[model samples]
Target: MKIDEAVEIVKPHLTKSRFEHTLRVADTAVELTDVFGGSREKIELAAVFHDYAKCKPAEEMKQFILECDELPNNLLDYHHELWHGPVASVLIDREYGIIDDEIKSAIYCHTTGKEKMSRMDRIIFVADYIEPGRSFPGIDEVRKAARYDLQLASWMALRNTIQFLVSKNATVYPDTFYAYNELTRQINGGY
Candidate 1:
């Protein structure tokens, strides 16, 4: 699907703030794709559809997943925040016929990230975190690091996320730990 069409489809599902954030993420992903030598089209498509299932009611998301026999067992225990990205990926693939692996992977990992992330995965993850509309603490530093150091920026962003989760006493998803460890290993290896 085209970026605009994807935006239109997801627009009604998001609040004004989230819709704006999505647009910013799309634009940021495009810019990062240009700078980092990835696929701009894939990045934009992933960004536009990344949160496609985010605002769905919990029961609705669960019901949709239950109706689909091929859904992953890994998704069974996800709470709302953890479920949204993968659920959105499945919905985008099924509903909009967005079947690109890079795009799907970006959407799949945008929330918590994963080990051995692709260039597109890193782009989408950083774009979502450092998008212009996002205003969480330490975002400015992440955005600044993104301009010159992709690996460092990813480490900072993941670190911030881990710290935030710890502060809130929120559950730390396994993928987050995997991503953090992978990123830490990369940084330590002088990447």
Candidate 2:
């Protein structure tokens, strides 16, 4: 679907503030795509719908997460905040016919990134984190990292994310750690 149609379809899934954030993420994803040589269409779709289930009632999100046979069952034990990514992918695919694997995986792992991230996955993931609307410590560092190096920026974002989750005393999904390790390994010499 076109970006405008995607936006309208995604609108009801978000609150006004979240919708604004999603817009910034979509715009930022475009920029990242330009920088990193990714598919703009895929990145836009992933970014626009990444947060589609983010603000869903916790119980509702958990229910969807629980029912998702494809998702790792361990996710059921984690907090609902992580449910949005996987659940959003399912929702968009089922409701809007957005069944593109790249877009779906991008949304699925946007929150807790996977070890084997595609270029598009890294773009949407980093774009979502360092989007213009976000205001957090070290954002500028991440933004700068994103400018010239996708792997570097992804590592920085993942590091910051892991740290944030740690600070919150939250469960750190293993996929997140795997992504971090893989990125760090790639930047360093080798395994």
Candidate 3:
């Protein structure tokens, strides 16, 4: 879908603040797409709709997660915030006319990430975290890493996420750990 169509489709589903953040993420994703090489169309759509399910009712998200066979059951056990990725992906794929597997997977793993993410997936993941709406410690470094090396940026972002979660005594999903390990290997082993 075109950016304008995607925006019109997603804007009503999000609050004003959330829509603005989505726009920023879309812009950032497009930039990363240029730097890292991915479909700008896919990046913009995935980034704009990435958080479509973020503000939905928890009971609704839980029901969708249960009915959706593609999503792992463990997603229901993670922090509720993590549900948006998979939920949005499923909903968009099923109803929003977005049939691309890469876009769906990018949205699916945007929060926790995954072991092997495609270029669009990596772009969405990092763009979401380092977007202008986000302001966390070490984000600057991750942004720089994103510019230089997306895999290194993924490792850095995962490390920062793990540390943040650990500090809060929150659960760190296994996929995130796997992503960190895989990215580490890729970066260190010169993959």
Candidate 4:
């Protein structure tokens, strides 16, 4: 589906602020695609729908996951933010017939990134964290890194995420550990 159509479908599900953030992420994703050499269409679509399940009632999201058999296994153990990405992926595919592998993978890994992310995944992940509307402590640095080096920005963001989760005593999803390890490996010349 087109970006406009995806936005229209997502509009009702998000708060006004989140809807605007989605637009910024889509725009950012497109820009990153041009710079990073990925399919602009896929990046745009993935960014537009990355948070499609964000505003869903937690109970409802959990119930949907319980009912859907194809949801990822890692999501089943940590059903909090862990389910958001995979659930959003399923919803975007089922509701909008968005079948592009790049787009789907981007959405699937947007929340808690994976090892060896694709260009589209990096774009969506960084865009979501460093979008214009974001105002976190290290956002400016992340935004700058995103412009110069997508992988570096992602690694920093993942590090910050893991630290934040640890501070809050929040459950760290396995994917977050895997993502951090993968990025650290890349940074350490393990590739």
Candidate 5:
């Protein structure tokens, strides 16, 4: 799908601020593609719809998890904040016929990132986290690292996420741990 069509499809589904964030993510994803070398089209589409399900009702998201065979049941045990990406992945395919595996996977795991992420997945994941509007304690470091190394940038983002969740005493999703471990191994021999 063209970027403009994808944007139009998602705009009405998102609040104004979120819509703007999506645009920024697409921009960041394209920039990452330029630097890191991936399919710019796939990266843009995935980033444009990464947050497609962000504002979904919690119960509705739960239902999607319950009914979709592709989604794991364990997702219900975690915070709903992590549901949007997986839910959006399924919905975009069902609702809009976006059946590209790369796009779906990127959207599916954009939030909690899975182990062995594809280059496009890493781009979208890092793009979503370090998009310009996102202001947090360690985001600048991730953004700066993103300009050079995608994997290193992803590791930093995952580390910051895990640290933030730990500090808040929030439940960290298992996939988040798995992704962090995989990246750690790739970057630092799992030290």
Candidate 6:
């Protein structure tokens, strides 16, 4: 799908800030794609749709997870903040005929990244985390690492996420741990 078409499709569903964040993510994805060499078209589309379900009602998102065989039901057990990415992944395919697995997977894991993430996945993941609008402690370091090493940047984001959740006594999703461990190995040459 064209970027404009994708933007229009997602625009109405997002709040003004969220919509701007999505645009920033798309631009960031494009920049990262330039550095890392991936399909710009696929990454952009994935970035556009990454937050498509962010504002959906919890009941609606739960139903999507419950009814869709592709989405794991265990998602409902996690914090609702984590549901949007997986829900958006399935919703885009069902609602818009976006059946490209690369785009779908990138959207699916944009929240709590999975193990063995594709280059497209890392791009969208890092793009979303380091988008210019997002300001947080240690973000500058992640953004700096992103300029040169995608894996290291990804690991930094994952580490920061894990540490944040631990500090808050929040439940860290298993896939997040998987992503962190995999990237740790990759960076340390253990993979």
Please list the C-alpha lDDT of all candidates, in the order they appear: 0.84, 0.89, 0.90, 0.84, 0.94, 0.95
Worst 10 residues of 2 by lDDT: 64-73
Local accuracy of candidate 6 as per-residue lDDT tens digits, 49-135: 999999999998888889989988899888999999999988898899999999999999998999999999999999999999999
lDDT of 3 by residue, 1-191 (tens): 77798889889888999999999999999999888887788788899889988889889999988888988888878888899999999899888778889989999899999998888888999999999888889999999988879888888999999999999999999999999989888878854
Q: Give lDDT tens digits, candidate 2, residues 1-191.
A: 99999899889878999999999999999998887787888889889999998888998877676777867768878877788898888888888888899999999999889999999889889989998888999899999989899999999999999999899988898899999999889899697
Residue-level lDDT of model 5, residues 133-158, one tens digit each, is: 99989999999999999999999999
Candidate 1 local lDDT, 12-108, one digit each (tens) = 9898888888999999988888878877777898999888878888888777777777556556575567777888878887887888888898998
Q: Highest lDDT among the candidates is held by which one? A: 6
Q: Could you tell me which 10 consecutive residues in candidate 4 have the lowest summed lDDT?
A: 72-81
For every model shown, the clashing-pair count is 0, 0, 0, 0, 0, 0
Candidate 5, overall lDDT? 0.94
Better of 1 and 2 by TM-score: 2
lDDT of 5 at 159: 97
What is model 6's C-alpha RMSD?
1.0
TM-score of each model, in listed order = 0.92, 0.96, 0.96, 0.93, 0.98, 0.98
The segments of candidate 4 whose C-alpha lies over 4 angstroms from its true place after superposition are: 73-76
The 10-residue segment of model 6 with minimum total lDDT is 182-191
Model 5 segments more than 4 A misplaced: none
